[model samples]
Structures are given as structure tokens and as C-alpha cells.
Target: MEHSFHYLLLANQATVHRQLLAKLKDTGLTLGQPKVLDYLQDHDGANQAEIARACHIEPASLTSVLNRMEVKALVERRTQKGDRRSFAVYLTGQGHSMALRVRQAFEELEEQAFAGVSEAEREQFLAVFRRVYGNLKEGER
Candidate 1:
């Protein structure tokens, strides 16, 4: 198969996902859970909508993910001040520990992925990827 942009993008995503899942196997987390955990580590107390947006997940999907997290005793959703209809999400102690694990997994992957790559090369790749991302986002609008 030709190494087209679409093929490379999808292949890289699948490969990375597989590696991450392997690393997180003992955690019993599924595909979307790690992303939410990672995001909530830095943005604890964010609302459902904020989490969905930041994590690029649909609101309905995020709801289910949050429900599972709640079941695992990894997170809590408290009623927001002055907004009975809205809730702010928070991490449990276990969730914080899991977040740290997730961060380490990500760092290990980054190190492996960039092994032997020059700093200048990494910067150039990031610059190009940013433009590619911007182009795709622009197409959505």
C-alpha cells in the first residue's frame, strides 16, 4: 500500500493505541478512559461539557466513560455552585495515582517514538503537524 497521508495517520493512531493499551493493561481501562484520566489530572473540577471538548469526545460518550469511572471509584461528580443542573468532575485519590501512571506511560511512548531523532527534526515535524491539524480543523468549520 502507498504510504498516503490518510493511511499513515490511521496506522500511526492504531499502533499507538495498541501500545498504550498494552502498557495500561493492568489498569483495566479501555480505549477512551486513559485520555479522560490524563485530561482530568490537570483539569480536575471541569464540567462534563468542558471535559468532552478538551478530550475531543462526544458528550454522550463521555457520560458513559464517566459512569464507568465512577463505578471504579476513580472519580466523583459534585453539583456545581449555583448550578444544580450542572456538575463538576473531580478525581479520587486512586484516579490521581492512575493519572500519574498514564503520564509515565505517555512519556515512555514519547521517548521510544523519538529515539535517536534530532531535536531540530522533532521541532520541524511538530510544526508541520500543527499546520496539518489546523487544515483539518479549518475544514470542519
Candidate 2:
């Protein structure tokens, strides 16, 4: 039985995500939390809306994550300068250290996921994946 391309693609993604999540569990972080920290590592002091967009999460969901992280002392939200209505998200020292570990974990997970694939095959996979992404994105327009 042949699996549809979408099914195979999504299955592979889910498997890899699960493995990564498991590894992150040892660090006392979850999938959602690492996403926020990863974004902050690249774009520090971004407002909540910006972080949500970059992390591809909803505002409501991001708010809940931020609240939890604040309680953990992983991040702090401060009013944006000259913008009382907007709050910027900043990683605490602990968050910065955690972000590095999270980054390493993700990299290791990806490496493990593609372990058996040849370099040529990996390149082909990425090219095909990007085409698939473009096709789906274009369809949405």
C-alpha cells in the first residue's frame, strides 16, 4: 500500500518532533517552551505579538506559555519603551542558558533523524520538501 505524500511527510515530521520533545524533557522544558526560547535567541526584546508570529503560535497560546515561563524565571516581560500598550519579551540569564541547550538538542535530534540517509539523499529531500512547501503555500493564495 502506497502512502500519500502528505501522510508520509506529516508522519516523519511528527516522529521527529516527538523524539525532540522527549530529549527536551530531560532539560525541564517542553516543545512549546523551546519554540519561544529559540525565537527569542534570534530576536531578543521582541514584543509578544512578534514572538508569537515568529514561533507560529496564536496570541492566546503564546500568552499562556509566557506566563508559565515568567513563573519559572526563564523570561521577563517589560513594557516597551514609549509603548505602554506593548510588552517586550526578554530571556533571563537562565533562559539564555536553556536556549543554548535547546538549540543543541534540536540539532542532535535532526542529525539522528537523518542518520541513515546519504548526503545526496538529504539534499534531494530538502529540495523536494521546499517544493512541496511552495506548492501548498501557493495554493493558499
Candidate 3:
């Protein structure tokens, strides 16, 4: 079990999580924030539900995240036309700039993660990983 792929994968995931936290420290961002920033990079003006679905975040949790972001002046929720209770979220100027930094940070991490691998090896590994993920997803249903 110590040397199993599943065990090693979990360890790698933890390492990546730590690395992400370290990278995000400078931006004054946290885990859920980056997901939202990445989502809003191209989908500015998205509604709460849309952002939640895209970011794989629960609606209730997303509300809190958005509320915190609003406090940071990273996003603003405006009333959607014809919808009094629903709002469309837009990145503030600061959020737009932060989004770019988030993208850069993710790119750098990806590059670092695969620093030594050949393109062919990376492609093959990802293909197998996808297949394994699909199998697990199917088993859940």
C-alpha cells in the first residue's frame, strides 16, 4: 500500500495543495477564491448558480465566498435585468487584474508539476488518468 499508485496519488495531491496555498499567499487569496477567479476570467457577469456549477462549489458556500470577495472589492453582484432576487456577478477592476495573476500562478504550477516529463509521456499519463477517473465516476452512479 505504501508504494501503490492510489497512495502515491493522494500524497501528490496533498503536496499540490500545499504548493497552491503557498502560491496564493501573496495574492491574499484562498482556495475557493481561485476557482471563482478562474471561472470569472471568461464568464464575467455570470449568475451565482452558474458560477457555482462551473466551479464545482455548492451554492450556499459560493454565497459566502462571493460575500468575502465583495468585501475585498474583487467582485460585485448587480441585480440582473427582470430578476429582482437574482444577481449577475461581475469582476471589479481589481478582480480582473487578480484573475490574470491567478491564471499565471496556475500556469506556473502546471509547468512545475510536469517540469521533467516529455510531452508524449505527459499526454499518455493524462489519458490513463482520465480513463481511471471516468471509471470511478461511473462506479459512483
Candidate 4:
């Protein structure tokens, strides 16, 4: 009845993600919201389609997340200069600040998670993770 290594890894990831997300709730951000914020932080004024692609989220889901962020005054959506039908997304000053905090929280959480792990072990773990991710994604193609 022992779980496989992959199962344990995935379970640990899920648990950690959930725990960190709970900590972020007070910042008025969710796990998915920060992805869009982080993208916009680096590439401001991106259209929904671009944001969705970069964030690896479906357009529909991105739309919902953007809507909520807009309502919270974290993002602003404006008509594109050439295309009135297309809107560009930008993070407000508040959103930019929150993005920084969110990034810090993620770093802290990761450090806490791997507190006792050596740097060599961490790099090896990341390599294995990337390979596993590639293997799983290859099956869908």
C-alpha cells in the first residue's frame, strides 16, 4: 500500500499550493490571479489572448479572472488603439505592488518547503520535475 514517488510528489505539490494560496487569500489574490499579474508586470498592455497564452490558462477562464481583478481595481481594461473590439490589460499601481508581494510570498514558501534540502538536491529535483512534466505533456500531443 505504499504510494509511488510520483504520487507522493504530486500530493506534496498540491498540499503546498493549497497552503500558500490560503496565505495569499488575505491579499485578495488567488493562485491563478497572480499568474496574470506577473505576466502583466513584465509585459504591460497585453491583450487577453496574449495573457491567456502566456499564463497557460483558457481564454474563458482568463476572462473571468480579469473581470474579477478589474472589479477589485487591480487591473484596467481599455480598448486597443487600432481595434476597438480588442482590449488591452494593464496592472494598476496597486496590482503592481501586490504582484511584488505575491512573488516574495512564493519565494518564501518555496524556501520554507525545501528548508533542509541542499542546493544540489534542489537542482536534481527540479530536473526530475521538468522531465516528468514533459513526459505527461507529450502524451497529449
Question: All models: lDDT?
Answer: 0.93, 0.87, 0.91, 0.86
* Every candidate's CA RMSD: 1.0, 2.0, 1.9, 2.2
**C-alpha TM-score for every candidate:** 0.96, 0.86, 0.86, 0.83
**If the candidates were sorted by their TM-score against the true structure, best first, what order would they fall in?**
1, 2, 3, 4
- Which is better, 1 or 4, measured by lDDT? 1
Select the stronger candidate by TM-score from 1 and 2: 1
Best by TM-score: 1
Model 2, 97: alpha-carbon shift in Å? 0.9
Q: Return whichever of 2 and 3 wins on lDDT.
A: 3
- The segments of candidate 2 whose C-alpha lies over 4 angstroms from its true place after superposition are none
Better of 1 and 2 by lDDT: 1
Give the CA lDDT, 0 to 100, for residue 118 in model 4: 100
Clash number by candidate, in order: 0, 0, 0, 0
Return the clash pairs for model 3, or none: none
| Model 2 Cα lDDT, one tens digit per residue, 1-141 | 239887887788788778778877777776589889888999889999899878888999999999999998889999987778899999999999988988888889879878999999999999998998889979978
lDDT of 1 by residue, 10-124 (tens): 9988988899999999999888889999999999999999999998999999999999999998899999997888999999999999989998998899889899999999999
How well is each residue in 32-95 modelled by candidate 3, as lDDT tens digits? Answer: 8987998999999999999998888999999999999999999999999978899999999999
Q: How accurate is candidate 3 locally (lDDT)?
A: 0.91
Pairs that clash in candidate 1: none
The true-versus-predicted C-alpha distance at residue 1 of model 1, in Å, is 4.2
Ranking by lDDT: 1, 3, 2, 4
